[model samples]
Target: MRQQERLGLILDRLAKHGTVSVLDLTTELSASPASIRRDLKALEDQQLLKRTHGGAVAAEVIYELPMRYRTGRHQEEKNRIAQAAARLVTDSVHSVGLGGGTTTTELARALGSVGRSLKVVTNALNIAGDLSVRSAIDLVVTGGSVRPESYELVGPIADRALAGIHLDLVFLGVDGIDATGGISTHDEVEAQTDHCLMQTATRVVVLADSSKVGNRAFTRIAPIEEVAMLITDSAAGAPDLERLRAAGVEVITV
Candidate 1:
């Protein structure tokens, strides 16, 4: 097939599956691994996708874009952050809360492989769905109206469901996270739900990439004090890292 046609097919797969491995592409396209890598590299150069350690995801921009537009960017870093965050969940832990967005969603994916049964409470429809099928995870979704862009179920139903439960840990994803300004996300209703999740969890560990480390988004989720720890990639700026450290929050950089 032509390179243009191959690139289009790869992106289509990414859009459909949320991820595409090089091995799968090699099989599907009946092409060499070298050829598949080249195609991924080409799409990455165009900023159409972000090449991961094994494959690619939809490329995301710097703005508060939709989930499809922002899931693939800095994926490698996000994976590392997810790994570090997942390490916090031990066998003693029972319930966990997950907020919406790519980073938290990645964390949910990581939890699926952990050899322990966990009760997961989440307002994000995608995250809940990801864990729902895993026998190791006893999933409790805060059922409510689903938001199209992020696939998070916010509003009264979700908040009310979480209100009755206390969680061991909470992993949150946000558009921007500033040391002084605190953690912030895009939508107001989602922000409100995030607050409820935070209040319900004993320890809140936020999963965010370096891009969101010092930036400020539309709505505030909580202040810096609300967070127990922050997990991010090495690409995070030293200035913001130092500021967060000074705030007495344990900042883990992978």
Candidate 2:
């Protein structure tokens, strides 16, 4: 496997099992012991995990993996979802809000590709950085403390920045979306900041992969009724989609 794919697999194993022995990784990944150790060393260098004598353990915060390591997972699905979400930005939408996540990052790229003039508001440092070079986009990045895990700016400062702003539409990237629990993320502070963004927008469209469809994270952003629509991949389970639709959320499977 390629290095990125191997890194993703190692991180995935650590996230699920909390620790991984080099021998086990070599066996599972079909890589040599030396290669596995090198991968472990690289992850440790990034502070993604702590290396032991013969294995690696989860980092200080592992519930939410760093954004850099998450880019490879469900990439194709995210791109397709992003394209479908971009289609929702009609001529009427001049100002848009984008929440931070791997999928929303793809949406940012999709929006830029369309070459439509828009005023974009966001707290994601990476997304802001990507859109800043686009002349067609008037980027407004909120001031707040950055969370390294998700590259999101959150807390009182972010909430304050979003207070008076109004958005025509907001596409939120969530870690989890459930029929009863609604939309949620791993961090409570991030959830609060995201909720603030949602409150400012007339329409809220959640962008999530199939894996997030039926999951519930640590904190809830809002109830299902609060969101206007959900744009997810077709791989999402029918039962969950039906439940979300029953809760009055417009479900669009790309």
Candidate 3:
């Protein structure tokens, strides 16, 4: 990857978990240790991150990562999670709510390609943009000011739009997935609207990569038990799955 793209990816990980180790980046980005170190140095020089002995921290306390940075991360894992999530939509279900996040955006494309006459309600402008031109899917955009980083509409207006409609299912993408504490996003406004969307759906399915398994973010969307199923990648450990299973959540790993 180019230097700028690598820096954005590096910052993306820092924004997600607040810190990132050199070893992790070497594995995640398929870059050499020397290259990772050089990138970290550049980011620190730019004051975008704080360099540590073996890792880095975001320059400022970060909530959500910009879409540009996050879309390229865990590409295969996100694709698998998206496919697993789309399977939940069936002939019995006509409408669905799609929460904003890189993973759910992939699920939107999967749904669209399947050519189902599905009604999809979304708060993310990116997801809307992807499906808006397609005639197969009925798309509804919740009205609210966009949170530019995630391109999600979050506010009373979005909540109001979702409050009046009930859907067959809602697929949520979260920043963190703690088996006991529940799911969460980086921003409180997004969390509020996510919770509202959850209430409007009969069943809620949460899509997350294994990286977020034990993490926590700023705002809570709902308890783990409230979700109908958890779709993730095989990188998830057995212990985490057991914990979620103990909480009565149906866990599906792809």
Q: Pick the candidate with the highest TM-score.
A: 2
Which pairs clash inside model 3?
Answer: none
lDDT of 2: 0.92
lDDT of 1 by residue, 7-95 (tens): 76777677668789999999998899999999999878867788999898887652234575466667789989998988899878888
The 0-to-1 C-alpha lDDT of every candidate, in the order given, reads: 0.85, 0.92, 0.88
Query: In angstroms, how far off is 175's CA in candidate 2?
Result: 1.0
- Per-candidate count of clashing residue pairs (backbone under 3 Å): 0, 0, 0
After superposition on all C-alphas, the RMSD of every candidate to the true structure, in Å, is: 8.2, 2.5, 3.8
Q: After superposing candidate 2, which stretches have Cα over 4 Å from the reference?
A: 1-5, 16-32, 44-62
State how far residue 187 of model 2 sits from its true place (Å): 0.7
Global Cα lDDT for candidate 1: 0.85
Model 3: per-residue lDDT, tens digit, 194-247?
999999989999999999887788888889878989999999988988899889
Model 2, range 128-152, lDDT digits (tens) per residue? 9999999999999998999998899
TM-score of each: 0.75, 0.89, 0.84
What residue pairs clash in candidate 2, if any at all? none
What TM-score does structure 3 among the candidates reach? Answer: 0.84
